[model samples]
Target: MKYVQLFFIFLVTAITLRAQTIPYLQRQGTATQLIVEGKPFLMRGGELGNSSASSLAYMEPIWPKLEAMHLNTVLAPVYWDLIEPEEGKFDFSLVDGLLKDARAHDMKLVLLWFGTWKNSMSCYAPLWVKRDLKRFPRAKSAEGVSQEILTPFDDRNRDADVRAFQQLMRHLKEQDGQDHTVVMVQVENEIGMLPSARDHCAAATKAYRQPVPAELMRYLTQHKKELIPELQQHWQANGGKTSGTWEEVFGKSLATDELFMAWHYARYVEAVTAAGKAEYPLPMYLNAALPREGKQPGEYPSAGPLPHLLDVWRAGTPSIDFLSPDFYNPRFQYWNDLYTRSGNPLFIPEIRFETGDEAKAFYAVGHYDALGFSPFSIESTDHPAEEPLGKSYDVLDQLAPQILAKQGSDQLDGVLLDKDALEQQITMGGYVFTVKHDFTLGWSPGAQEEQWPLAGGLILQTGPDDFIVAGTGLVVTFAPVKGNDLIGIGRIDEGEYIDGKWTPGRNLNGDQSHQGRHLRIPVGDFGIQHLTLYRYR
Candidate 1:
């Protein structure tokens, strides 16, 4: 009997250890949370510049800067050309060095695989692959001129990428599997076709004339009601044929050309992703370079994972966890709303890395229940500690516990304020909150400026009468949702969370709360305030 008990205990211990080593995504309430080491982790992350992670000695000073900035995760690339220099030879010294440094600094990493494609060019491919044109053909333009991108129609190109990626994953599992310093991986960097919507290479041209795959047609028909408006409208406009060639089914326009290319690109990426996941399953995603407004297909890198091609990518790449946008264009909110369709979790892997990102971070986590957020070229700042983003990150680190708990719940809300869009109304805990940009107040220093700097913050209801508001540049007033009763401020305490505990510093009233008219965190300041409210007739 004692021997039986010991055997059971050993079995349970081994199972738990295996579960704790792999990081994965899980659904929490209405949001999808990345579970690491058996707990939910919010990534306050930044992506290093393209060439930053190529050398360990060059990255020594950069680590301290990242630590000072309060970043918990670093998004660095693992270049294919460097990792696999020769046909079948592999080198993992760069990857190993990155893992060791990140672990030493107590930071997590999201590895970006700069594999077959980077920004629609095959510049990252190994020399052998690039030089052997006969063995591995390049995609051609409409005029039959060869371009730099490898044709996805070739089996050799896809197999080569799969072998390299599988090796990388296998190495990570054998080397750092227990520590799990790496949380997630991006499959490629901004994959898309350049200067043309569809490849005009001989293989591509021949494939384009073949009948559309039955699998994709089935997906569209099965998900007809749920397809994005653009894709659905295009299909319906062209008669929604069940059996026909790419041009015959989707019409002979540039839109159809883009659709054809999108399907092939997704399939190629899926092959690589699936192979890596088989070696070591981690949450994997793809990022898209958003197209500029009014640009037709072929004008920009076409048929990459943009919003319109999401359906095609989804149908092709079941191994890809989700699709994300790399922000270099305008319309932040517009793009975010589109990306979060059909319960897809939001994780911004790359943004412009500017002044207003602090606010967007708050709004993204609070408003959309985003899994994580990151900025591009994160090591460019001169003063890492004094940066506005650093200050914002410090507060976020303190509030991460509460933020993670309240995500996907009505108790949390965030607001982004700018000159044109000054005010937003939020209803929580039976009270209506009127949140506005700090510049809306005439007495503020930058109120009269021609362009107002962006201001934003978040509010979390802790109790029926208690709430916490944290952010920069904002004034808030509250009113009851039901009755026509006046809401009075019982007390407002300016405070900070130390060790996940609220430490109040000042009882803000009179002048601090604008003589009880409103609660304000000035434009230049980043802080947290705990407030208690009461109702009066």
Candidate 2:
């Protein structure tokens, strides 16, 4: 009788705890937040390289390094082969270990489901699944040559992938559901077709000749105003027809084939996402392998969640929260702007782990009011503390509290610069600021160098005349926004945020401010400066 009562009590406690919270995405005005444990969280996050999360022993040495790097969330892969190596049986040693280690480090996890497809190839699928090609057919090129990529047209392929995924989600619910440690799950990695815009498999080929789905046509018609321009132009040029084959509905082009592929890929992912959500109901998303410049559909990955295919994705996957970008492109602002259109919240899951990644982090969050920012291959660095990314993350940690508060509000903006573009302008608090790269000063050795490093900052309007300016290598000269009036920096206090409050260290007026000409924080110096502006006619 005593044992029965104790078991019942524990079970009820677990049920109640699970009911209290689940990881979700919440929109506060224009900003979106990853709500973990019923609280809004900014993911100061990083993703381990493709193979980093496979071993507990391998990850042990890097925990302290991540702690020093200031990452609060980790995006790691959950291998289909490792978790469910056999047919019906399962093993969760790796999953449980990842959860345990993340909790130990006081970090959150976003599990990437490498099921059936990873980077458009079935490379991550279990050996049993891979070996049985007839059971799970692969996608084919235009000449009927099969590629490693899986075709979405096969229901059998979908069923097997769905089962493995369902099992994974079910296991996650049992293990970490109460803890809310794993916040989000990416359905697959860079899913798309290669060397073919649309799969040449028999089912896919037949479907391509068939009329475009009525649902997709309806979406294009309804969301015409909001649809991306490239897609819209093709639809309009086709006389905005509602009924026709794939090429007839859109146009006869590589993009048309891509449209066909995007729809099928989205539908396939949607089924997986919807089924997984049924078990646990966590927020899910898909990441796009960006299309390179001048590359047609087959030249790139072709279909995976690119901007033009957004409507297709939206039409296909209501279960998906939003589409995310894996940016390796240099035109950071352009790509970010493309992803954030039509109320899609910006989150960069993976980016090139380069020198400018740190600056890009500041520009991304500060300028875009982004949900989160993370650079790829997080464990590859030799000395974590010595890295520029660590310094950038340090500054971001201090400003995070304020950044979250003002994210959806219009009081925040950021700037970015390179050798080609040395300066930019920002308007806030009724004043226009000439924000420029610190290399313009010509005082530092970098000023003499041909290349200008990425310099950027966040301008937060704390009051009508007062503001907080934080970032490296930037100078701001202010003037009245609506009239001809000279605006002078009344006071510029260099400081750091301690315990959510500003502590001033030095006052800049003479050379630091160009003798009251412009307020500046020089190159290679990352700090916060509080400034008060006064305007005179």
Candidate 3:
């Protein structure tokens, strides 16, 4: 009996240590990689529709579809109301079910905590918390009408959220810590204040009139040079005061209200995230509902982790690891550039699930070295094999090995082409390569349409004069950057990657490459081709 007890003790300790180990974002060369179980991991991920993960039945057919798309991770939600309906009492059936199913499907998970706020609404709060307006207050609009959003000013609100989140983390640690199946977790979804720039409730109104937190002021004063342009401009407009009320320090405007609310929001989230860390300490992040074009702070979901409010969020929630973009906007490149500013790693937790997203995914991973990209409403799509996204993911999976190796290095570059932009120029390895939209070949039916389809490629310079170029569409041409010598493609091996090793299928030449004039993947064909070039004197 004593031996049996000792054996059980040892087993429990082993599981605890395994669970404690977490995957982290680490830098290699100049590129950041998501390190899972002490090795680099690429997230070929997809997010479920809002209500899809709620039922085990709804997700039944979806699992195979995700696997068909070559996804490595599933971004599913964990609702606060469902998890803890009776306050202190918690229910983790849904979470456990997800873990079991995920393991069965051989996929990792990134659970999105739909707590307090989901897209800036208190839609996920429990009935008890939502019922008690006095204790669990809601944010208000300008005319004192209460909005469904919770006020960050209330301590009860923060404590309730923290308690619920802590319980969830504890449960995850107990259940999944040893398996390490869930690589990272999202603390909340598209967090923001809406209908107005700032919360107008009594508590929020009272706090707005007070001076900004000294910690925030100090952060602004300390990181003045590195502040995002919008935040910096707001501070500079009011003489960059050492300390004062929100308006007095940052001027009287909607931006000021946003700045004020952002601080409280960030602080509130920090408490919840810190509490969760105490239990499981999994990698946690927050996603921002981007500020829309032509929309003011109040017009869009203001605050959250929007680019301009990074300073406030950084000061408010130092516990939060990183910020990610929910990319619904058309300007993918511009938004990606903005999020990665200030050395923050780029990870797309959600984007529009349009077919064009496949191109954006290739460009993001290749150009920006993004940690991961997940399309929203992934299960909504039918027939993964017929979809362009599936084909894109399949190719991406093949090239991931080389892509991860070249991350943070100048040898890696990519370009996106659509109807508006048909071509781009890149210089790498002492040569200038011209990448164009495949439609330029004018051979395919879509090529002659009024608008060209999306096409892109990831270019990796593996050797001094050799490159592994993979993607659909576009013709690539090479030239010596500093000489009159003509460039020639000595050999082009069209092949597939299996287990990080290139297996050549066909020697592409003649018509496939415009008679060896350049390298072409052609329109309507998705492939990878290895090219070795030589410059003639």
For all predicted structures, in order, the TM-scores are 0.97, 0.95, 0.96
Model 1 lDDT per residue over 405-460, tens place: 98888999889889878999999999999998988878876788899878888999
- Output the better candidate (2/3) by TM-score: 3
lDDT of 3 by residue, 330-425 (tens): 888898888888877889999989867778888888888988889999888768877777787899889887888888999998889987888899
User: Candidate 3 vs. truth: CA RMSD?
Assistant: 2.6
Model 2: what TM-score?
Answer: 0.95
Give the alpha carbon lDDT tens digit for every residue of 1-537 in model 2.
999999999999978976668988888778888887766788888999999889999999988888889899899999988887888778889999999999999999999999878888888888888888898888999999989877899998888888889988998999887888898999999988998888999999899999998888888888988888888888888788889998888888888888899999888998899999989998898898897888888888989998878888999998999999998876788888988888898989988888887778888888887878888899899999887787878888888878887888788888888788888888888998888888887888878987778887788988999998988888888888898888888899998888978789999977788889988877777888889989886
TM-score preference between candidates 1 and 3, better one: 1
Q: What's every prediction's RMSD, in angstroms?
A: 2.0, 3.0, 2.6
Query: What's the lDDT of the predicted structure labeled candidate 1?
Result: 0.91
In candidate 3, stretches whose alpha carbon ends up further than 4 angstroms from where it belongs are: 1-20
Candidate 3, position 256, lDDT: 86
Which candidate leads in lDDT?
1
